[model samples]
Target: MVHKEVADHIRSWRFIVLLALIVLTFITSMYVSLRNIKPAVSNISDPDHLFLYLKLLTTTDNTIPPFHVFISFLGPLLGISLGFDAINAEKNNGTLIRLMAQPVYRDNLLLSKFTGAMVIIATLFISLCLLMLGGGLLLTGVRIEPQELLRIATFIVFTIVYVSFWLALAILLSIQFKQAATSALTAIGVWLFFTVFYPIVVNLVIRAFLPDPSFLSRDEIAGYNEMILNILRVAPGQLYADATTTLLMPSVRSLGPLTMEQLAGAIPTPLPFKESLLIVWPQVSGLLAATVVCFAFSYYLFMRREIRS
Candidate 1:
């Protein structure tokens, strides 16, 4: 069943379009990053070039943002596109009923759909990462260090989990809504809200509550900023962004606002791979929890849902 679903996704036009857009964005970002990397590399010493390859993968040029930025933006779209119709389309075509009639369990069927989608997504991301690494190596001639490779590997895993959360959400929507169009639009609307409008809305709410920032003390202002950052982290997009930023740019030491005392005696150097992971572990856990909750809800609802042609 998993194999069949995987093949179906591969042949689908939606998959084709999503893959094309991602590949195009990645190539464009890499091209722009490579162009600006030369000057930066020339200024840095050889010994200090640790994780330079990783930097190339994520450094933004004048026009284009980093490749990981593109991933953070488009990853949800890929998930939503693949999963919005997973079960509803089966039911629409009268296949869900037929498939359920076979010896296969309903749980297995739903799991197959999710697993198949995950497999495809993982393969696509791994391939893209390898491609980006190759391109970075060829263009910059910087060798990837062991620590850099570990960080990149962790980034890929985090990305998969982050995208899987959307995939699970779309699957849950697909189970709840009988119409494919309804599920698709609802998924896209949720994505747009979290990605584009959520930050604006957050700022407005924070302003309404805090009124004037000038009236607040330094410590109070720092508290407010920390509170706002925490509120934004509730969104999965923000969590992914924070995690990727920490992972890709090891120079990032904290996710929240840091005070002068906290910054005192801090070395201006990239963190080791383990330290980077420790910094983003909470974000990673959040993404994992979100994914599990969505999938569990879908599984429960799917099992209880009345199936009819």
Candidate 2:
């Protein structure tokens, strides 16, 4: 059942469009990185010393956004596209009720759909990462260090979870809305609200309620920034940005404001991989919790839903 669902997803035109868009964005980012990388590499004494290969993923030429930024924007779209029709289309066409009439259980069917979509999403991302690594190696001759690979692997896993949260949310929408179009639009609407309007609304609310930080003492300003940041992190994009920024940029020591005392003897160097993960663990957990909650709700709704032949 999972295999059949996977094949169906792979054969869909929507998958083709997603692949094209992602690959185009990847190539554009890669080109920008390659163009700006030579100068950066020449400036360093040891070009391939540490996270050199990561430069391909994190490096940017100002005008074009880096690779992960593109993923943050487009990844949800891919998830929503795959899951928005997971149940409704089949039910609308009279196939879902019939399929349930057969030997397969409802839980198995839903799990298969989720797994199949995730498999395709995972495969596409892994392929792109490999392509980036290979292309970067060929062009710059910078060997990928062990730490770089670990960081990339961790980044890929976090991304898959982040995207899966959207998928689960989309599936929940699909279960609630009878029409596939309604579910798809609803999912996209939620995405747009969080992505575009939420930040503006947050700023307006904060300005109206909170005092100006410039007038506050140093300790008060730190508290103020942390408060705003916690509010912003409610949005999934902010959570993702926080986690990914920590993962990709090892030099980022803290997510929040640091005091003069804390920065007094701080060295300007990359953090250990485990330390990076520790710093962003909360954001990662938030994404994971969101994904699980969305999936659980969808599962319950589908199990209790009444479908007629």
On TM-score, the candidate that comes out on top is: 2
Worst 10 residues of 1 by lDDT: 41-50
Task: Report model 2's TM-score to 2 decimal places.
Answer: 0.96
Local distance difference test values of all predictions, in order? 0.88, 0.89
What does candidate 2's lDDT look like per residue over 1-309, in tens digits? 989989998899998899899999999998988898776566554333257677778888789899999999999999999999999999999999789889999999999999999999999989999998888889878678788899999999999998999999999999999999999999999999999999999888986887876688888878877888899899998999899888888888999998788899877788889999999999999999999999999999999999985
Best by lDDT: 2
- Residue 107 alpha-carbon offset, candidate 1, angstroms: 0.7
Estimate the TM-score of every prediction.
Answer: 0.96, 0.96
After superposition, candidate 1 runs with Cα above 4 Å error: 43-49
